[model samples]
Target chain A: MTFIDMLGAAERQNHSMLCVGLDPEPARFPGRLAGDASKIYDFCAAIVDATADLVIAFKPQIAYFAAHRAEDQLERLMAHMRRVAPQVPVILDAKRGDIGSTAEQYAIEAFERYGADAVTLSPFMGFDSVAPYLKYHGKGSFLLCRTSNPGGDDLQNQRLASVDGQPLLYEHIARLAQGPWNLNGQLGLVVGATYPAEIERVRAVAPTLPLLIPGVGAQGGDAAATVRAGWRPGAPIIVNSSRAIIYASSGDDFADAARREALRTRDVLQAARADSLRVATP
Target chain B: MTFIDMLGAAERQNHSMLCVGLDPEPARFPGRLAGDASKIYDFCAAIVDATADLVIAFKPQIAYFAAHRAEDQLERLMAHMRRVAPQVPVILDAKRGDIGSTAEQYAIEAFERYGADAVTLSPFMGFDSVAPYLKYHGKGSFLLCRTSNPGGDDLQNQRLASVDGQPLLYEHIARLAQGPWNLNGQLGLVVGATYPAEIERVRAVAPTLPLLIPGVGAQGGDAAATVRAGWRPGAPIIVNSSRAIIYASSGDDFADAARREALRTRDVLQAARADSLRVATP
Candidate 1:
């Protein structure tokens, strides 16, 4: 199935929009699993086994694995994802941006080598930089629109001249993204949950585009406001929470705590969906 | 020595600002070195040995090696660079960008793992994304400004609104880079030789910032115009030429051909330096 269809299926089967971020920092991992690739793999596998049914997707930030010289850690992580949760999507949160040829190699690395169902991309290099990845009909590409960090407004919010003489940066991206290059409909936008107004504005421009909303839990962003600003009638949205869910407990029962946190977030997401449906019906 | 001092020494020692790019494509390799990692290493080592004293530095585009899953290729490539020309700096052409935590990991991978003197970075994720790398006091970070590709103008040329209410995307990056964050003075900018006017504008904004000029030969960029635009009076500048130098010949004498092309480019850069000195004196 295509990425969109797979997302729809995952949303229905799991009954949640929560995307668990599997960003395993070596410094923060349980002491028992520290300093060994095999032990880290086991820890990640246990978490996947416990929470496969509670969320729509899993996002493994590539840098966390890449930081250590774990040669085959990425491949092993993808294998664990496929074995435990075949229906749920695995998004490789690698914000890669390069020229056309290099971008093609990165696409192969994310899709063929690691088997990511979707990958995040940096859109600063222009549309052609991302066009090669979007050519993959079965995979999805999430463009960085507004990030979650404190310095995100540095350049992303810079006002430029739109074709119609308005605020340019994100609107330019929105206009181009909604235009000809999205023929496969596998495009998504990354709008940080911290900026509710920007999320609403982005939604108004590209209402049909799926959004990957980050920065919800530990980042102090309100989940209710995010769902209210970002939710579409029946469109796809994946609300990701990383530190709050994964590191809920550093003890041996960490996996259990992760599952509990994931369940709580799922319940909240389901209630938000119900409220969004009510508003749409009214 | 720091990256700035090394650049100054290379320019003075070689009497040239040319930086030969080592972008080795497997298909373009010599007959004996076809499709093998060891042979590729030998070929690159031979080229470095032949051309080390003729140019300012060597730039190896990371994507070419990454494309072929040649196990331990990057390690071998760095080993070859160290052995062939210990004095010449190696600039890794990997345009990586991400969050602060993730960027730190990449910095470790590039400087610690690969032993590169400098690495290219994309500034799309904002300042925090690059701050981790800049923390390495002795290493160099080249932020992408105006690229040489055809579609680069799409975003890089967009007129952004500044606090002074002027056109300001590249200008904003220049102004922000001048603050305390760049204390080590190891920061540089990557502006394409194809956009000489933009290069001049960027230089006018940040006069002391070193510049890495790519797109010289095969990309049809004017070498003289770029030298005129960016050459400071007896200061550091690296003019990179990849395909034109590396693939100068597809025969058994490929390494020799590469050395010859590098020599020619080096001569042109020396002449430009001479002209800059004359202009300064007048």
Candidate 2:
């Protein structure tokens, strides 16, 4: 199945918009893990087991893995995921962007080597940089439109005089989305939930495109507002929460706290979706 | 010694601004080394042995090695570099950028695990994102300011209304370099030699910061113009050439051709430096 279909099925099956971020920091990990690859794998597996019913997807930040030269750890993590919950779509958050040939290699690594259903990319390198990944036929690729970082406005909101005069950088990226670049219809945009106004604007421009929304819980982004901003009838939107859910409790009951957080996030998303449906009916 | 001091020493000793980029594409490699890691080791070792005298530094783009998950090849590549030319500085071209903790892990990998003299970074995550790498004290971290890619203008040139009411994204990054972020004073900027004007502009903004100028030869970036734009008296400016040198010949004499190209590039750079010196003295 295509990444979109997988995501839609997962969302419908789980009835959740929550995409748990598996950002395992060696320093912040509970003493039990203690920088051991096996222990790290165990921690992630337990969290996945607990929250699998409450999340549509899993987003693992590749940097956390690459930092450790933890190739073995990554393989183990993938094995654990495949065994425990094969249905949950894993979205690898790599933010990789490079020239065409190199980008092809990255695509292979993300899709074939790691078996990620989707991956995030930095669109700063232009459309061609992402062309190789998009060529994966069924795999999904999310381009960074508006990030959750404080300095996001430093460039994303710049008013550029393009053919469509006075357009922001994000707007330009959205406009490009309408071209042949979205060929396989697997293109998605990462419009941060932190920027609801911009999210609304991007939605208006590319209504059909799926959105991988980050920055909900610990990032102080409003989950309700983000759900409202990105809500489209039956469209896929993965609202990710990392630290708030995964590290809810660093103690022995960390997995339980994570489950509780995931459950709450899913409940809120379902409530928002119901409200949107009600308003549309009226 | 500081990264700047090491760069200065290398520049004087080699009498060249050339940084040979070891972007070994497995498919494009020559000889019996086809898809083999030992061949890559031999190829790189031969190039280093022949050209270490002509160039100040070697930049191995991580994507090349990373694409091939052949650990034996990577280990051999590193071992060859250590054994063949210990004096030449190796700048690992991995554009890594993550939050503080993850960034620290990357710093450890680049400086400790891989033993690279410097590593390139993508500064989109903001100043704090790269702070961990800068905290390495003596290791150099080159921030991506102006990339050689065509779509580089998408965000790097975006204008923003800061407290001062006028700040371009690249300029904002440059300004950040001047503040406390330079705690270790090991900050460097990556301004592609493709844009001479922007190179001059960035140089003017942060004169003291070393510039890792990529995009010469095959990328159509002019080395002489870049030297004119960024050359400072006794400052470190590594003009990198990857494909133009490494892939100079696909035949069995490929290593010799690589050496020849490296010599030619070094001579051109030395001439540019000499011209700049004369201009400065007069």
Best by TM-score: 1
Which digits, one per residue and each the tens of the lDDT, describe model 2 over residues B1-282?
Answer: 766777787788888889998877777887766556446666777777778877878888776666666444655666677677666778888777555555677787788778777888877666666778876778888888877677677667766543254666677677777565677888888888888989888887787888899899888898888888888885578999988998898888988899899889888888888898899899
Candidate 2: deviation at residue B87, Å? 3.9
Cα shift from native, residue A125, model 1 (Å):
1.6
Give the C-alpha interface root-mean-square deviation per candidate: 1.7, 2.9
**lDDT per residue (tens digit) for residues B124-195 in model 1:** 778888888877878998888778777686677777764465655766676666554476678888888887
State the TM-score of candidate 2 restricted to chain B: 0.94
Candidate 2: where is the Cα deviation over 4 Å? A79-84, A161-165, A178-181, A251-253, B37-39, B71-86, B157-172, B175-183
Report the error of model 2 at residue A79, Å: 4.4
Give the Cα-based TM-score of candidate 1 against the true structure: 0.94
Q: Write one digit per residue (lDDT tens) for candidate 1, span A20-42.
A: 98877767776577556556567
lDDT per model, in order?
0.80, 0.79
CA lDDT, candidate 2, residue B9: 79
Candidate 1's displacement at residue A68, Å, is 1.1
Which one is best on lDDT? 1
